[model samples]
Target: MPTFLKPIAPWLVILFPILTLPLKFFLKRIKKTREILALIVPVITTLFVSSYYSLIVNGEVLTNTVFKMNNILNIYFRVDAASFLFAIVSSTLWIFTIIYSFGYMKEYQNKDRYYSFLILALSVTMGVAFSGNLLTFYMFYELLTLITYPLVIHVQTEEAMDAGKQYLTYSLSGGALILLGIMFVAFLNEGVVLNFIPGGLISKSLLETGRSLEITLLVFLAGFSVKAAVMPLHRWLPAAMVAPTPISALFHAVAVVNSGVFGIIRIVYFVFGPEIVISLWTGKLFLVLILITIVLASIIAFFKDNLKRRLAYSTVSQLGYISLGAFLLNLEGLSGGILHLFNHALIKITLFFCSGVIYIVTHKKKISEMAGIGKKMPWTMGAFAIASLGMVGIPPSVGFNSKWYLMLGSFNQGSLLIMGLLILSAMLNAGYFLPIVVSAFFKEPITDFEEHQGFFEAPVSMLAPTVILAIATIGFGIWYHFPSLVVEVVVQNIF
Candidate 1:
């Protein structure tokens, strides 16, 4: 909040992670130092991002132009309510994930390279959050794909390599569509200011015929939808589960998926504005598509035996909820959508973390193989159960609160079908997620697994974050006002 910090705050948040990348190489020989540095850098970065809380809540916009290239391209940063919320959530979660990674990656090779790209991904994610314009967001968005490819293929197996290739194919294709959309925007309005304006920067005169508007909007939506994992385009997600568990937890469940939907939010509220979206009738078309993703992904998740892939499919479904809320175009809907962005991140990451612990402790990837895992890893499965319930929108877990608002938003829009879909999606959520909790707790242990005593949980570094996030699932649900405060600010500005 300091006056001098305004210009430099955003860059500092990003640089803290990048600055550690070199030290990682310099200390490559010392594993302990590298690990500690990995934990400490993200802590510092999260704190720096949190420092802007008051600024954003007070409705102040922080903009810094790092570089300007003619009129079409530039490096810029803006910290508004939306960006601040994303920056803080991702940075804060990165800390726990790094801690979890210590236990998860202890025996793995190339510790230095993994940690380096891990840190670099945080920097790039921050760039995506704070990007001031479509061009800046696009640049960082593409960088994110490149930075994460190594992580996806860290195991270097044939499956991992194939998954990496699929990831690149989907991501680069999406990026190309996004670039085409940006070029169209530039062409339609020569020398147009591309900075994100809450009400939208596209001129009304250009939208008279609505044809150009519809085409550009479709291009942008289709481009961003690939990353958003909007079905047909979501295959890369399940395939990329070949990576390590921590990567699945933080990147796939939280950072990477959010970036895609976050881009769509920018396109809707910042680039086109809600009015334009509604006026063009594109909102209805995209809303139907998102609803399909919501239901279909949940149904698909129910059948997946692999825990990570199940969670991967669940992420696809949950992302649809976020998109559904945003397109609702009403205050309650946007509020629910934006709030779910944070709530789902917390809940889903916990689920993934629990899955990681189960994998590390039992080497069991399939749900059918995890019978009675709860007895052996009580703390881990306990956390997983809580998160699973939350995912189903049960009370006293944060997921219920966001879904509540989304339903309200649907009602406000007079679309009982959307409200019905929301209800049906919750049923599907319970259908898929609740059974895992039930099987882990009640079903007898499988014959192939050795019998264990009670409570053989994962290492404290891994177990602690899972438990903490689980507690947060209920805690934040009860104390919903905390996150709602920020979401309120975001909705107020956008509406």
Candidate 2:
């Protein structure tokens, strides 16, 4: 992409989140047109942004200075391989999400505010992906958490309100930690131009002094960990499950939480040089924590009975795998982890989207209530089955490939026990996901479902976006090799 167009791609990332503000006012005059307008803007922006970066993928880092405000504040952006990868993921999947939300939110009032935050949330996410400095990234990251709060509490009930408060509290605390990390980084890099350079700008003395490197890494990890839903920091996620399905779909799938995982990768590889991080005890400790998170979250998932809550816990377990790969401190682990970012994202989103549709059509939240739902919403629930199988790391889906490479990386680590934990987690994965498929398809329908031949699924808007995502999940699984190529390129060129 030409450097000029490169700047525009970052703009597209925030197109949704940014527009939401004005959209709220526009609805005073434009009212219901907001939905059609919502569909048009994000879709157009996604296409425009993707094409711009696709042009420059050959061997160039597209950079643009959006503003040179001052020494303290600057408008800096760039489209690198990493930025291109994440921006496209959000902008594209968000297009489908908006479509799904249209029918999903049709009956709800106050949609003006609803779609408004949806747009703003997306826009800031783009900002997070394309940010050029610690300062800029922190700004956008906070914006994402703040803007999505309305969506989290869209239902306006006592439970929804409580969930929103907890979400805000946790997310804002994360923002504070991130801000502290940014100050330390800026304090270290006082006069240098900022870029996603390998190894941070901090001096060696600071890194070695008083376990500073370990402490700094922990601050960033604790900051980013809240959203990534790492163990002990993940209570907010299941609590936030009280929101409507679309909100859950958007936030958990790729918007709110993905930003956290994305931030960890960006900080690890871009902020602290991978080599420096690996040489320190802090990095090794984080790796051990992620491995423990993977095993433990999977075990917890096995015991949850609420549909969204089970999936909520499943999200925690999957994120552990992503963290494990990122913290492994090698190419296989990094590549596997990065690829899992996309793989787990698509599959997990599909699972949540389908779950949302099931509740909308059936008024059911527990897995047991979904018995025989397969007969009602075959296409909808069928995708759920396929996605569940994929979650269990079954073949012919994208999740299988992620698990395969993750295990390969574990084996590469020469730890026979980590390899065992990998297998055990998959079995635990099956323990939660498999039963849902079995309950919906193999078992008799719940009594309420027996007479409901009149309906098979949620609205076309809801079911269509979900099934499409399910298809993308399977398709993206097999396409894992393509990202492997990109990861090889990142290593060869950047490292």
Candidate 3:
């Protein structure tokens, strides 16, 4: 890439997908053309993002300013190690999701609208990842909520519509809180541009003296927590499970929830910095709440009979680990938290993919209905079993490595309670996930599935991604150093 052209990288990545919106519309009647466009856009976007990997790994920050409305509001894009990590993970996994969608959505209605919003959501998520300032991030973040709303209600049933309304209510309320925090930041800093800095934009002297700093932290946490699915703000998630499984798998699992977690990260590490957060009481309170969410959500997950709803609650619990890691304010905790963002995305998506395949093949959604499904859909259930173990933090799976670092972080803090909560959460994780696996593989077939025979599985398109991500759950666990390298760069920059 040319030195000057490097600045255009982010714009190109964003624009490529947006440009396809019209192409998709033009080719609406041509189903083959639309499918090819949908598939190729993500692949090209991922390639473009990867081309910049060498630059990011070599410690270069690519920044572009579109324009400035004033000192306080500007349109800016930046790609550093942190943003690059998010972009690469989302874009890379998106390829698999798109491929999986081909198989899963083949019979579904509204193909054009689904693929259109789906592609548009990718652009918006990239915007969130590359945003260089609070204002920039907030704008893109709001856009993400709107773009994905249609997907949430794609089925258009009364239940789906209700979920969409609830999603909007929570998301808009969270966005409002974030906007208020931005105003506080601007007023405190005398209208300085709210650009994200490595250490923090807020001065330590101000942090120590300003009581409002604590309030500001609270507002930001509350805002991002709604989307991160932190407790009291998490009801929207379980309700939204009525969405089609691919939408649930990608938007709910990877893009939307991760964006919320990513925002909280920016607030703690980039906007406020660890030093400032560590000195505030709000940080400890937030940490305590995150621990509560981790354990409580897992307990709820154990009792849900519906598989997607169970996974929805599981997502709520797992997301707390990331937030917990970020708020710990220790290097080990931050690294673990950041790394889990990618690791958990891989594991959760695999689970969701497997669930979609199970529903398609056997029309089974409840855990009780899945007995001996392992015999009929061996490949699907095997991948599900692998992902389940990963979710439980078993060894040689990626989930274990991130959880290990989290425990180290808790130990570094010398807080036995935090460590205990994590251990308890893991046990709870096994309580819910292992039983399903055991019933599928070890128990006798239920009457409904007794007629199923051996070696049947989903289409290659759907089964391939599930198996690949399951393999990656262990593969990346063994080669943990690769992702850790990116995370170390991120931690170095922030600390």
Candidate 4:
């Protein structure tokens, strides 16, 4: 813990929840007011996380006793380098989404309620990012599920409601698994050492026999898998696209899905430890499942005509890359996986946000409907092109950074088959993604396609977020050096 991080403690636990109230009740009818209120917390958050240089320098372990339960259920919070890393991603992007939602949802009647959900979601996400222990993380995790429900069902249609219901079921069931795992750990009654820093939690001799270890591993993987949007359990993600575009960005890219990946990371590094990850078949299992998911989801994505559904499947595949890096159980793989958690979020959210912008302006859904769309909505299509390129793992984009590490990790493992599979997956990614970009920009305009003639890329608010994220995707990708200092802070205790 660094001293600069101490400043972030009060911000996450106290000021964060306080920031949401204004948007939830009083700002319900006022879109402009709600947007203003949304800025305060995340701005504070960014300042806090970006202060990593100072925090690490001062060597302050910023821990807060938020509350406690039965001595065993201590509700504490901390924002070490690991916590700040995710916190920065979630909170920073949230500011963009909140801004984007302002204009995106302006036409909808319930602007106030929409803003409220955004604030609550951000709060819960921050809590998850900064949680000190499994118990604290679970509490915030369940809260995230509940808070984002309204965002998912924002359309208030029967379809939206169904999606919301199923979404809740998947998320809550995952949470329950996590809860059970926590209880089991508690029953073992290890002293109140709760923070989730990666590496071996206990000595290898403690659970080296690997029986209870496997059962607990199942609980941990199943719980986090639901959020990671892994295969078989990922049905809710595409269905949940009934949510507004900003919400979709929040769920798939930034807050919701990342939380799952983040949880797996915590389990691997903190709960079980990297030593445990390597000692058992856990590492092998993680690699196997992630590779299987990458190929399976890519195949499924090719058949998806619905644009959002395609993105959803691609998401599952991409999440596999993140999960795979972790399972490789090396510095390159783990660091790449951890960093990709943020990089992918930026790229995917921008892609979805662009799709939403098109839908908002032209009511287009199927890729077939987007022919010559670039002519009508140049800005949106341009942003779409860049974002899609990023998704395809092209150069000068954040997606490239994640894939670069994935490739390096694979090579480091000397796993030629996984490397080959990675290449094939990238090609598959290009196959599905290129056509959408090409259709939008290269194809001749079809007369029958409806164009809100005057409409151009939703609104400035929406367009701005998409552009910013798109630029971020490329900017971070090109200059991509993980600040050695930040890494030192984050991975210090683990490695």
Candidate 5:
């Protein structure tokens, strides 16, 4: 990283986009300039994050104090391997999402408001990623919820507003639980440092109050798991699909859902450590819950005919895989879980982008309506198929590589049941995802809707990102070393 950019690089990645909001008044005056600026902001953020790639990969932890709360409790920003990885992914993908949105939102109202909140959401996401301690994490986590609410309710329809309310109800409740859990930690330690520590902060002897400790862990897990969409808590996600496609991609694949997964990872490996968690009944219970979420979500996905709803269910199922991998409490399992963070982001985002493209071009949003649709919008459907295959854990795709690590992790833990669970989940993944591909290609195009069909495709702005991400599905899968290496470093640091 350049010395000049170093002091502010981390903050800049977040702040630059935000500062653009005020400039929106001027940018919006010129349509072409506004679009160009929107794209430039995220691109610059991505570059800034990448500039720190070597530092994070080399296992450096960068910290900068934001505020002083007292001797032991203060808000600071830190970038380690885990945060760096997430920052890069979010920043890079935000660029593509903005580009895609330009094309998708062109016909919609409140473009300025939409773009402004989008940037705010990204800023909060960066805050969550770089938060130096649990307090910092919690503060930003709460802010993330509020900032994203407008995006969730963007359409202002009855359904969209209802979904927005559900989003707030679930998210704020979960935030309260998490805050309560954090309070419990402070009480337990008199002042627990929110810093990430390898192998966790709590000692076994400190957990003598077993039930209390177990309940606290459950509170934290349940809280984070809501956004992670673990079981009954997941209804908000499917409902929130009433929002725009870019928001769906942002919530599901990039920021909102992933923050929950990242929180679980922090609680497991950083706060309580694997040894403490594994000894508690909560560990076994969490593992079981995650598995149930995986299997049940996949089954539900198989039955949903609505395209985005099915994908939403699919996000729920995939998130379970991450939690299960983390709970396995071994190096391989942890690495797999972390690796999937990136893998699933790429695969799921591509899938959502395709959904957006289809909606923009044809106004069709159901699986039943998509038969023979591939012939008209071949690139869009083709990308969708690639992403679908990746989601199913096909070899040489990012998803397969992560699942492979997860399987090995399960084997390392000597749980053949988990290994079998992977197999079953993969099959279920295919049962739902592949059918869409098959119907798009093998089935005849619905003729009653053939009123107008000739080389149909989403606009260049949207199609470009979809294709790039689709290619990335294969590119990263084939060259898995980079993500695998960083994830391995992160796991090593934590464990």
Candidate 6:
């Protein structure tokens, strides 16, 4: 790396994108300029993060403390293998989302406001990825909620407004619970610092408090689970599909929901540790909730004809797999969960991009209405089919690789129940996703005149990203060794 760039802390990966938000007004005066700036920030961040691969993977930790507001309330950021994995996934996929947004958002109103929040959300997401302590993580975590509200309600329609209100209600309530958990830990430890390590930060004295400790754990889990969209707390996500497609792809697939999944991993491996978390009935309770979420969300997806809505429910279920891997209390389990963190981002984003393409070019949103879409838009539907197969855990798809590790993790626990849950979930995934592919290809167009109209494809700008991500879905799966090594390196560091 160049000496000038060498001085830059990896945390600037977050700050760099944030600096763009203030420039929105000036950039907005020229539409193309604003969009290019939005795309450039994430692309630059991606390059910066790639520069750290050697340092992060070699276990050389990078730390920068931003502020010291007394002992318990300092702000800190650190980069490690695990955080870098998330940082790379978020930045890489976000570049494609920006590209997709250019084509998707061209005709939409309030492009300035939409781009600002999208950029800000990316900055805060990087914050969540690099946060060095609980206080810092919570700070960024809450800011993510505030910044994403505009994107959720970007349409400013009555339904969009309602969805935004529900999103805030759920997120704020979750934040309150997280704060309560932090207070309990701070009171017990005399400071609010909790760092990621194999053994958790909870002291023996605090553990002896028994019920109090359990309550704190449950409180923390409940708060973060809302974003993870686990079970009953997941209502806000499906409702928020009122937002534009790029926002849906970013928030539900990659950034927002993943924040919750990341939080649960931190709690399990960092704050509480597997030793303590596994010893409690809380582990079993969490496992049961994740299992319920996995099964139930897949079932819901089967019945929904609205494409984005189906994907929303699918995200809820797939997220359960991540949480399930964490709570399994073993290395194999943790590794599988973390691997899916990166893998699923690519898979889900491709699916959403395809859905957006379908809507933009054809004004079709319902799966039932897409009978001849495959013939009409072969490239778009082909990408959708490939991603759909991956979602079902088919071989040579990225989804299958993660599911393979998760199954091993489940069997390692000697829990037939979890093993069975994985199989059943895959079946449910196929139940919902495979039919879309089949309908697009094997089934005939519902209307005869459409066959005479011939084929059409989305704009190259819109089509290219989905195709690239779709290819990545297979390429990453086939060449799974490197990414698996990265994930294993991260899991090895923590466990």
- Cα error, residue 215 of model 1, in Å, equals 0.5
For all candidates in order, the CA lDDT equals 0.88, 0.77, 0.90, 0.78, 0.88, 0.87
Instruction: Point to the candidate with the largest lDDT.
Output: 3
Over 1-495, each residue of candidate 2 has an lDDT whose tens digit, in order, gives 223444354654555456545654656676567887777767766765666554445646766667776544676776776666677777778888888888778778888788777777777878888887777788889988888988888889999999999999999999899888776666666755555654554555565566667777889999999999887888899899998777887777787888888889888888887777877887877777777888888887777778899888888888888888777767777766777777777787788888878777777888767887887788888888888888888888888876788888888878788779888988998888888888778888765853444453567888888888888777766666555555565554445
Q: Which segments of candidate 3 are over 4 A away from where they belong?
A: 1-8, 25-31, 450-456
**Model 6: per-residue lDDT, tens digit, 1-495?**
222345358567888988777776665677578888888898888888777777765767788888887756888888877788888899889999999998999899999788888888989999999998888899999999999999999999999999999999999999989988888878877774655554678775576776887888899999999999999999999999999999999987789999999999888888887878877787789889999999999999989999999999999999999999998888888888988888899999999999999888878889998886787778988999899899888989999888988999989899998999899999999888888888888888884323323334776788899999999999999988757877877777777
Model 5 C-alpha lDDT per residue in residues 189-210, reported as the tens digit of each score? 7775667676887767777875
Q: Which residue pairs show backbone clashes in model 5?
A: none
lDDT of 4 by residue, 438-467 (tens): 887788977455555455546888888888
Candidate 6 Cα outliers beyond 4 Å, as residue runs: 1-7, 22-31, 448-456
Error in Å for residue 25 of model 5 = 2.0
Candidate 1: count the clashes.
0
Deviating ranges (above 4 Å) for candidate 4: 1-6, 10-15, 19-31, 56-60, 69-71, 189-192, 447-457, 482-489
lDDT, candidate 1, 1-495, per-residue tens:
333333356777777788777776677587588889989888878778877877877888899888898767887789998998888889889999999998999889998789989999999999999999989999999999999999999999999999999999999999999999999988887878788989788887777855888989989999999889998789999999999999998766567999999999999999888888888866778888999999999999888999999999999999999898889999999999988999999999999999888878778889989887787778988999999999999999999999999999999999999888889989998888888889888999884555555454677899999999999999999998768988888889987
Higher-TM-score candidate of 4 and 5: 5
Point out the higher-scoring one by lDDT: 4 or 6: 6
Residue-by-residue lDDT tens digits, candidate 3, 27-52 = 66875887799889888888778777
In candidate 3, the residue pairs with backbone N, CA or C atoms under 3 Å apart (3 or more residues apart, or in different chains) clash, namely none
The C-alpha TM-scores of every prediction are: 0.96, 0.92, 0.97, 0.92, 0.96, 0.96
Report the error of model 2 at residue 357, Å: 1.4
